[model samples]
Target: MNRDAAPWREDFRGGSREAEDRLFRAMAQAISPRPAARPDAAPVGTDRADRRLFHAKTAVGITDAALMVDRALPAGLVVGHFRPGAILPAAIRFSNASAIPQADGVPDMRGLAMRLAIPAGGPHDFVLANFPTALARNAEQFLALAMAAAGDWETRLARLASRIGLWESRRILAHLKASLKLCPSLAHEHFWSASPYLWGSRPVRFELRPVAGEPPPPILPAPGDNALRIEFASRIARRSVTYRLALQHYCDERRTPIEDAAVDWRPRAARPIEIATLVIPRQDISGREGRWALEQIDRLRFNPWNAPEDFRPLGSLNRLRRFFYAAGDQ
Candidate 1:
């Protein structure tokens, strides 16, 4: 929306033109209509791990939010040490998936965007969700899915009419209809990169596992209570969770295309997880120190395209993102 600050338009040339056009079109359409809402499915299985759902209603006014990457880190876990490379100081921000800053304890898959300053090499960045895999694979698939989900009110009415017309004649039609759902509220879910990326010569993927503990205590509303703010402040004060950063690598030659986000790479050999610890220290969210830290860290941006050649993001989604994200920011 900030035309002058638009980085995509200024840098648009070479391979990214088509993606840029598609993104703009999608944004335009998304703003024009009331999309249909899908019915929630009945809870499926008894397995709590698979059936648990997290949703958070965020508070207003915070434009963006971030997690301090190193504040709770386990000692000696290195940052920026690629094979044949040296360590570098890096900063990261974690936010809710919707891009708006929300109260901390809301159920959502935390969003993490990291920026690593590479001395003598370009900075490496990433945009990630907490899941182990993604719902869609490529830019085209993602675009189509998003468009279908954003169908206007008339589109929804037409669909309903069609359903009614075939009601008596076709029971299968009812079962076959696909429902469109909005992106899950990030607070209550975990996200994944869903695509493979390079880490040195090995191909790898990342996941964010929440710290081991029961969920934070529920917030009680009072005369002046802001539930999310209070929960986040208290949790920061108590320092409740600890998450481990882990990586999975591909050893099979068949996984080399590295250009499709949809295909699951079968591992010829699997390696044990190398752990990196993340810890958050206690602090007052509104205090000067907390505010300054959050401002400096949260405002930082992470672009997956900003990596050394050996570790570059290589899939269709990554390529598409290289353009669209830049355009959106621009």
Candidate 2:
């Protein structure tokens, strides 16, 4: 029994013995790799279909261009909507995802997690990563990947020996191996919902795509390389680019298999993508309003399980999150 690990009793808090065992088994299966004998499947493009579907279903007055906005919810802010036309204001925080204590200029995935107060729809919260798909599908898979990446002393020594042997044996000539490092700038990177969820009346996933243009120049680390931060600040100052929230729907089962996360959604089966523009205005992070917004988002809880009755998350990851997220909240 690893003392650092969570207890089995904790896992069974509100369940019977049978249920606990089943959960443990499911967790085990999620962490294990798929057998090599199983070949990978094809990708799917569902965003196009979702766009067409959403447009067709919306009321006559709701034009595709109407969804664009010039400002986002404020930092650590909450907004409530009482009536169809009524608007309530709130604050929010935008930062890098690496958890490294640094300005937004650091090369890493852009994390967009926010909490919004809706008078009618309950609290709205979301956490998005820069990539369209997550590195792992579920919590267990996440754990396994972390463990694999965290090589022990023996593993490190073995890798070193292999490199040395290769060099001595002349097996490789001038191998230009790039070191595994996080990116410094996130401006060009697009954030994604990662997990699939039902969007409005249709089942779909969401992704933030950058407008067509070159990102700011790269800023490598140096004695005083605060240039990345400067670039980020300048971009916010100019406010040139506006992101589009593209929704993709699943149409075909064969190409866009729901069970696998590695495969991209097939474009062939994809519905037209409905786009919603998001414009972020510059705000002082140290200001009282910004602090308030950060506090609100941090204290507030956001889960896919908190979604409307019709829009449930599907697949093994969703099922696992339903249990674990609830437990963590408790």
Candidate 3:
């Protein structure tokens, strides 16, 4: 932690206020650092799009979807864009979580980035992941991990051991290995916010689960790099895919700490209560209109900070996310 300033401390409640500046610099360097000169070609690194620090792989699909807020929900859960009986038009992008593009067979984190078109104001974004918890606890730990990853085998191992220790590193590795296995289809997998957000005045975590009665995705004899996309296309060609959007409210600081995103609050907190539904319509994204939609979506930036004031993101990790994401856009 840098611990050199205190002015921005008020914005980040229970956050790593000291590490924010250092984290910003580190993220900027990691994403698009000045490169060594080349003999004939342009500079080694200049393109921001090509140098995205994470989740830079091809999107599995960028299609239209709708979010229907439940009309029968209790009055308390109805806040922000989740107004009862509201039908919000949305666009969703499914992606593999890797700085470099890899095959679908590879066991890695997956992402579900969504943007809702709100009639009241600007689009609200939700960046969800297949994993229920983050690998790092805060911006400082994330910076250390990123630094360690840039080193060689021996140096990386030593740095990991020293920075996060052997047991914690091993635990993260095991968790990733078990949870990030090859997905039969993106539509079947659940997506979690993993971090907290302010639901009006209260903090809450959200997730999306596939609706019941959809047939299981086929077991490919040998899945290719686009296996997930292929499965989704085949299924959507026949019928629409739907999901239940639910939220788990915060309990207490000890059980559902706002600062630590690495902790899974599901164990101690109450089960998630359903509030809305998401439906991906049966349409061809492979055709001309679909291609146009994909191109437009790829050009758009989806950040969790693009939300209503009442639904602002919480925690140090999210605070770090807000800083870096906004910085990247600039």
lDDT of 1 at 56: 19
Better of 2 and 3 by TM-score: 3
* lDDT string, candidate 3, 134-203, tens digits: 8777666676676776678577757877887888777766766767677777877889998888877778
Backbone atom clashes (below 3 Å) for every candidate: 20, 36, 0
TM-scores across all candidates? 0.55, 0.55, 0.85
- Per-residue lDDT tens digits for candidate 1, residues 146-196, read 444446745643443343333421332232232111222222333355576
Best by TM-score: 3
- Would you give me the overall lDDT of model 2? 0.41
Candidate 1 lDDT trough over 10 residues, lowest sum:
45-54
lDDT of each: 0.43, 0.41, 0.72
Q: By TM-score, how accurate is candidate 1?
A: 0.55
